[model samples]
Target: MLLKSIHHSLDELICLLDQVSDHDYTKSCEALSNATIGEHTRYILEMFKCLENGYDSGILNYDYREGNNQIQTETEFAKQCIVEIKMGLKSENKTLYLEKVINGLGIRIQSSYYRELLYNLENGMHHQALIKIAILQFENMAVNEI
Candidate 1:
């Protein structure tokens, strides 16, 4: 069921991407402090990617995203990333460790695959809201319902 919600969100995101022109998709938005829509989409995808990469290792580290510039500069590449993320979401739930740096110290907390998926869902939604705000900053821009 959670996977269904995540897939639905990705579908909506893909639909939104289809409506965005290449120019608008990579245009830096003042509302986002000069961040592009593709950048936010990349961030959203990378979180899930971190989870997927860590599923086998049993350690998830969000601070270590590869920061692929292509994902931020190419809208089609970002869309392909979303599709790949959906494909990778079918793993069974398992015990996982979320490793993070807090106050200059690394910490690990027990987590599960499903729990991280939920976190990714909420994170994606939050970024989507920011993306909407950025789109509104464009002159004569129309945001389609997603």
Candidate 2:
């Protein structure tokens, strides 16, 4: 059920992307505080990437997840990333550790794959909402379809 929601969110993102041109995808939106749609998309994708990267290692640290600039600057590459992420989404739910650094201190917490996946899904949705706002700012694009 969680995976299904995640996939649906991803599909909605793809639909939103389809309506956006490369120029607009990378263009800064005033409504988004000058952040590009691609930037948000990269952020959303990277959360899942972080989870997937740490799934086997049992150590998830979002801060250390490598950022892929290409995914943010290139619409096609970003779409391909979504495809790859969807393909790699399956895994048996198991204990996982989430690591984060705050105020110069590192913190680790016990978590599970499903729990992290839910977090990613929620995070993606939050970004998607921001993306929707960004989409609305464009006069040329039909934002209602998304």
Candidate 3:
């Protein structure tokens, strides 16, 4: 059952890619991976870490490792900032840490939703945000109509 589910997921993902144009596919894929969104909806997600010794002794600052085949020119500031945010979770303050995690998730969700909207707008998909909204809002709108 698990393997079947995995296979179905892969097939669905491939079909999604095939349905969109090259540009929309690329944009949506990158937006999925990139927390730092772009275009009019420039939503930058925090990494939950802080860089620079000023923030924390363990926080990495300007230590761009090489030969690991990673993004060569990663933003050190952003990386550190994320680290700092993560450190906050380790603190005794549960409420604060939970809030940070929730906010981060919300930001990620909004970015992807907007990306989907943008891709549909660009690639001439059937529905933009309104279509997606309607589908979500639909109650027993399926063929069964129960």
Candidate 4:
């Protein structure tokens, strides 16, 4: 049930991306201090990828992620990443170790794959709300509410 909701959120994000022009997608918004919609999208996708990596390796570190510029500006690349994420989510459940840096200290907490997936979904939605605002303000585009 959680996976289904995450997939649906991802689909909604993709649909929103499809509606925006590439120029607008990459355009920096003053409200966000010149952060583009693509950047937010990349952030959201990378979080999912991080969760997947954690599930595979038993250690999830969200602080360190591959900084792929293409994932930010290229819509198709982001779409591909989404597909990979969906596939990963459908895999067998496992224990996940969530690593977080709090007050300059590293902490590890045991978590379940499904719980982490829920985190990713909620995280994506938070970013999606920002993206929606940017889209509405910067470009005359219709964005679906998440």
Q: Which candidate wins on lDDT?
A: 2
Residues 1-146 of candidate 1 have per-residue lDDT tens digits of: 89999999998888878777778889998878999998898899888889889988989999989899887777788889989999988658999999999999989999999999999999999998899988886676556554
lDDT per residue for candidate 3 within 64-134, as digits (tens), equals: 21222111123332234333433443321111111123534521112222232233233322212222233
In the range 31-99, model 4's lDDT, one tens digit per residue, is 888899999999999988888777768898988888789889988888888888888784567887888
Quality of model 1 by C-alpha lDDT: 0.87
Candidate 4, residue 84: CA error in Å? Answer: 1.6
Clashing pairs in 4: none
Global local distance difference test of model 4: 0.84
User: What total of clashing residue pairs does each candidate reach?
Assistant: 0, 0, 14, 0
Model 2 error, position 43 (Å): 0.2
lDDT of 3: 0.25
lDDT of each: 0.87, 0.88, 0.25, 0.84
lDDT of 3 at 55: 29
What C-alpha lDDT, on a 0 to 100 scale, does residue 103 get in candidate 1?
A: 95
Task: Point out the worst 10-residue segment of candidate 3 by lDDT.
Answer: 36-45
- As for lDDT, the candidate ahead, 1 or 2, is 2
Q: Which candidate, 1 or 3, would have the higher lDDT against the true structure? A: 1
Evaluated against the true structure, the overall lDDT of model 2 is: 0.88
In candidate 1, how many Å is residue 138 off?
4.3
Pairwise TM-score winner, candidates 3 and 4 = 4
